[model samples]
Target: MRNPLSDTIVNIPPSGIRKFFDVVSEMKGAISLGVGEPDFDTPWHIREEGIYSLEKGRTFYTSNSGLKELRQEICHYLKRRQRLEYDPNTEVMVTVGGSEAIDIALRAMLNPGDEVLIPQPSYVSYVPCTVLAGGTPVIIELEEKDEFRLTPEKLLEKITPKTKVLILPFPNNPTGAIMNRTDLEAIAKVIEEKDLFVLSDEIYSELTYSGKHVSIAEISGMRDRTVLINGFSKAYAMTGWRLGYAAAPALILKQMLKIHQFAIMCAPTTSQYAAVDALRNGDEDIARMKKAYDERRRYLLREFRALGMDCFEPYGAFYMFPCIKRFGMTSDEFANRLLQEEKLALVPGTAFGNCGEGYLRVSYAYSLEDLQKAIERIKRFVARLDGEKKC
Candidate 1:
């Protein structure tokens, strides 16, 4: 048989974060901070809604765009929380997860060879999704000095006639970086000037420790060109439910819907029903979970500082990207050694992007107890490395 794989697919590297996660899974006593998943279970009310739907025999496929009630609830949630309004009937469509929304958005917008500006050290999906959609992936390396926030100047340097889409992954995954209204206004200016579209992945929108998350869709004139992707996973702790939605201009949404309708048919019915309840009555759950994550966030930062590690104070998401450059090892080496020597599993920063070479991404999504243990092990590991260097 001939070698028969799509070169594009073959060329895309596997998820770097998952590599260590798999290793940790097999180790008996490993404490993993590798994956980006929320550690909390779905709130009991939300879970009960799903159970209720199943008992009521609502195990049928919804409309290709998803359940009408769920879509409307999504619109309401976005408006109430982010101050961004959308026409649920035409502009919003639910998908399997935020990951699918991202893939389909790229497929809907990108023509062959169109250029997409991706800020580096972002969620792992953006670059590969762009490539698979037949778009050119143009990386804009974000600086740690700037807290990994994408700058308008960096945006300008990357734009060309072929530039079609910019992915704004805020409340960023590996780095926990965020862009405030003023920061987004600058980038919005550049996007508008360049006549580009945006795919704003605000999955961690609810996890910001600072001020509220500002969606680019909320920017003046940006809603028309932005596809806002969010979901129940991070905010509602419904990762297993796999429900997400995309809100964009109806014209763009129509094309995305075509791809989603053909590819996925519809999101799971029970999940949609649960998600409707989540959107309608889940604010308290969000507040409670956000408070927990915030506490863990502060604890990790203080612990990292006390251990003399160069950690950027993350104000969003559950991950901390701490610089491990001083140890004179690659991020991969540092992560591997820590795991081997101390059974602590953290992701290498380079798993996010090449620019992340000298850092490690430690997720604080674990419980405070687990975090405390991991920190103690990490402290010991670093001390040993320091002693070895002195020798």
Candidate 2:
């Protein structure tokens, strides 16, 4: 009856993106360009594998690290795509989505007051998870001019003697930004020289619109010090499958698996079986979905620019961070008005971090038809704002 909650947990804020989503859910005839989910179904082949697993009654638990087959497939997939190698037996572990991999990795590594350098306008889970892991979250604000990438200079500015980890959220979420090889090499040099470890969240690796996605773990000296996290959710339209993985050095993985062993037991057996199929046969599915997403991304950029809205052309992820500063409203205010007046929902950029002020994260994962409808509404809404500015 005394203190019901820990002060630490009580002080953390809820996700800012959910507020608009909850409102849009109840509003009639609302169109949402908010949620970062694929419009496509889990490809028929992938779904069939899950059905087959259930039909075969493979419903029991897999090993805590996951079905050996799925882990090995994950290793092969990474090697094929990223040129990275891992021992499936000791270096890989399946998790309950990338979120779990993130949580357990932080728990395995951090001690109280260990500073974690996190760049702004990144996935919301990083800061909260770092805090829960007993690490102090040091925010490094990424610049719009830098395309929301974490620059080496900016990263260096935040590092302290207590800095223990850097969370690299690239092919970034809200901003759709990606760090090319040169961009990464510069940052990797700093990390190596500073002797800092990394938590590279590459869940969107398969969704990049430009050249191939590069993992910081691919850097010469970094894999041993990096935990590479990825999953099928974004890549395979397998969100509900709840399967993800982490490939880390055996020493670090041993500790992470210990936490996962007690906390999660294992990822879903059916999902694991299906994921092996995905890793093996889903490359075509990924390419197909990415093609559609890129088309939508380009269409939205053209529409936003044609309306004279300032939006940077993003090269990765399915979200677009368009500046709403010209409308003279804060992101939350503009998004709120857009939802009320037009029944169109988008995530306020500030939902990711303070640096996202004056911007909105528009997801292109919705269909081209849905995107066209949403744009008509946005067009109308912005026209009125334009008229008001002139008056």
Candidate 2 structure quality by residue, lDDT tens digits, 209-259: 788999998877889999999999999999999989999999999999999
lDDT of all predictions: 0.92, 0.93
Model 1 clash tally, residue pairs: 0
On lDDT, the candidate that comes out on top is 2
Instruction: Compute the lDDT for candidate 2.
Output: 0.93
Show where candidate 2 strays beyond 4 Å.
Answer: none
